[model samples]
Target: MRASESDTWLAKMISPQSEDESEDDILYNDRKFSWSAGYPHWEIFGGGTRVVATDALTSSSLFSLTEAVAEIIKREKVTHAVLIQPVIDILMKEQIAIKLKKIVILGTVGFRSVLDCVGKICDELVNMYGMVEFGTIAAGSYRVNDVNTYKHKVLSVKPLPGVELKVTDDNGHLVPVGDRGLIQVRSQKRFTGYLNHASRWVDQLVRTGWLNSSDGGYITTDGFMVIEGRINGLMDVFGLKVYPFQVENAIKGMKAISNAVVIPIREKETKFCVPCAAVVYHPGSENTTQNIQEYIREEFAFTKENPIMASVYVPQVVVKFKTFPQTSNGKPDRHGIAAEVKRQIDPKKYECIE
Candidate 1:
């Protein structure tokens, strides 16, 4: 290829977490390339068994995904893309809406996160892109048929053949539909056992032919699985169960915050411990730490109907970050972020939580 035709974008699949793993630059190649098939970068580049011409333009270090895509469309004469759901929110605002066709989201964090941003995606892109085929994947839980029309925009994951799903509570009892519980599945597709980690596999995964997904969810009347959060080892506050995603989504909804991550904060005085949120805000956001804390308090204010959950679920602190530290897989590094919070948090500011 000539220099003019060679402008492929290589997206960041993951980054190293620690200095010890500095030698390991987690990226895709011929062997591990299949893992990236569902991501935007792979769709752009990574030569494979594609019948169509999917010439990708590399743009890895950019802050705004939309901006990067915009450049690619202009330069590469691109017309379609298979992007993750999170990118659609920002991408919809750009002029690229008039270009793309398909929008496939590989839902690693569940389909609902994409669903939350679907309105903007459909409204902004659908009319322009001509009824875009936008959907997400949730391993064994969500399927192609699960993606429905706007009014019927609910997640319905049909368990595979010979896969029996069980949503059980703490004591392994079934909960009613729409009520959250541990998601256990006994499937032919499920792994029989780990290679050598017998104890770890038994303790964390397989139990009586059923695989504990370490996920929490509820089945709707229509057989749709509404994911709540991770079930294995969730963070707590004063003996009250709190989900990090719940708090993170709330913070992300704020006008000032562009991105958010909620992590477990270990406190000796607190009975169960507390939550700390590290956020990346919009440019020109005149938000102070007090304002951020106040916003969380108001958003998570206790309700009279059930004062317990709302009260305990609220964040004890919120910290600002230029960019959240990411794990090798491009996921938020909660532990690394927590350590940063500890370093930045003032004694006087956080003492109130105790």
Candidate 2:
């Protein structure tokens, strides 16, 4: 099917209005298309079909509760599967194996860690990037045997057909390849406007066609896109900018940490924001708070050229969590965790780095 038509069908399927509309009304709108018409069914494996499973909240756009139930009923052997990062984490924690041939992972945060865990189970693993506003933007896959060697490409995604991406500096000028900047996207099949939020749409539109993704990332010289994190999520510490993903990625790289989230917490006296990390350690890990803190210091200290800037990235306070609070869509609840971190931290005990 064409991209525009596919988008229209997806929008209708997930829109709030869809709850009131009948299946026929959703499938046979003004386009006059049938539900099964032109639906391409690819034989990804030898006579094996794909089965999807999601634990996301019902309100998630990825799949409705009803669709999830139907898919669950139809699933049997589960040769191919699609899952989000959180679901994959759960699988790893539970020590459950589905014995799948192929898997496609949806979300971005902590993708590398999850890929490392699941790469051994499946023959092929694909990392997909997309949002509700636009359909599948970019995707890349790695074979099971190449997992360790291709770790650098875990977050790299190549744009899909007809999708255009650019990284621009704060001044709205394009940056050189491999330089970090604000990421913007333009596509022929992109959503036009919000239901009643036209002004919001206008604010995000950089020009007539391009839309500001509000994401900070860089493009590689080889033409792959790498998303760092949300532009708004960047923390300013003593006049230095630090990306939470960079810190979280470093923390997760440690042998003990299973998952981690870094947030900016403002110091009471100076009112300056400092990075605080909440971590989930692997089962049976005997590492203490001091060990994790020392690890971060050593990791950031390796950069001799920017010791001052690297110091800002280190977390002043570290808290341990059994598991991260999750949002409705099953992603880590960063804001909620930040609130809890503030509550747990005693301002008098830990002072901000000067």
Candidate 3:
């Protein structure tokens, strides 16, 4: 909106929207607090009140996310801020870094990956943004983070006081410490089942009394958690297991790559799924499919003697992309990227055997 339209827009939008508004009235595409209306989830922590904010109302939210946070709150300063589901796309992280530096303890959700995105953006968050402690946080549609618990990995979160969470393997056994598995939760606050789809509730949500969260992560010795990614995205190639994050992480670590996604593309004739990559490289990067393949070979190929090198799950093809498509949740949409990659690959010309 223009400067003249500011007042007109302000008159229409009620900040921190009223608790009295109807549920249907409160939720929209841009608004974030759909679960609890517009009340910013507040916690009495670190002195005063710690306000949690997110890109609920994208246009309105980004204003608070990047600029005028303290002014919008009408406070001298915002001591603590928790961000969730806001910085989903990769490029937006730079925007957030440059703009969001006022709050002291800025807990955000930018880098849900294993690496702390603060490194990617540089330490300027402290000098420029008034940030002392900043890390990715764990908060989502179904649950809130343990108000008292804070950690480094953004996805590492503890369920609320009344909730019981379990990390389990494929056989339903509890994963040993440091090993990744599915996160399952049981709580009175949790939804019992989805309406009309009772069986889907069993398949997707309810696993006995516990709800299968589908999120993948590992618990630490001290009980802090580190989420990896979705367990359902696992791809199999020639009977070997391949994980998207594992391949993507390896690719991103390469010097030439700026961003990368390893997506599973199923071979139409053989029906065997092969891992392919969509890469975004630094400007003027001399990256080629052969070199990218070599990087993955060096990173993940088990050994020549182990047969994993021959059966390696590295990208068979590396297609260049200007940017990644955002998922509904605003994260990088690997499935969407895979669909685009499939269109470019000719099945008759290219082998899909990995």
User: What's the TM-score of each model vs. the native?
Assistant: 0.64, 0.73, 0.58
Q: Order the candidates by TM-score, highest first — what do you get? A: 2, 1, 3
| Candidate 1 positional error at 185, Å | 2.8
- Encode model 2's per-residue lDDT on 19-38: one tens digit a residue: 33354522222332221112
1 versus 2: better TM-score goes to: 2
Task: Give the runs in model 2 whose Cα sits over 4 Å from its true position.
Answer: 1-75, 86-95, 117-119, 151-154, 199-206, 301-307, 349-354
Q: Number of the top candidate by TM-score?
A: 2
Write down the lDDT that model 1 would get. 0.50
Position 336, candidate 2: lDDT: 72
Per-candidate Cα lDDT values, in order, are 0.50, 0.62, 0.48
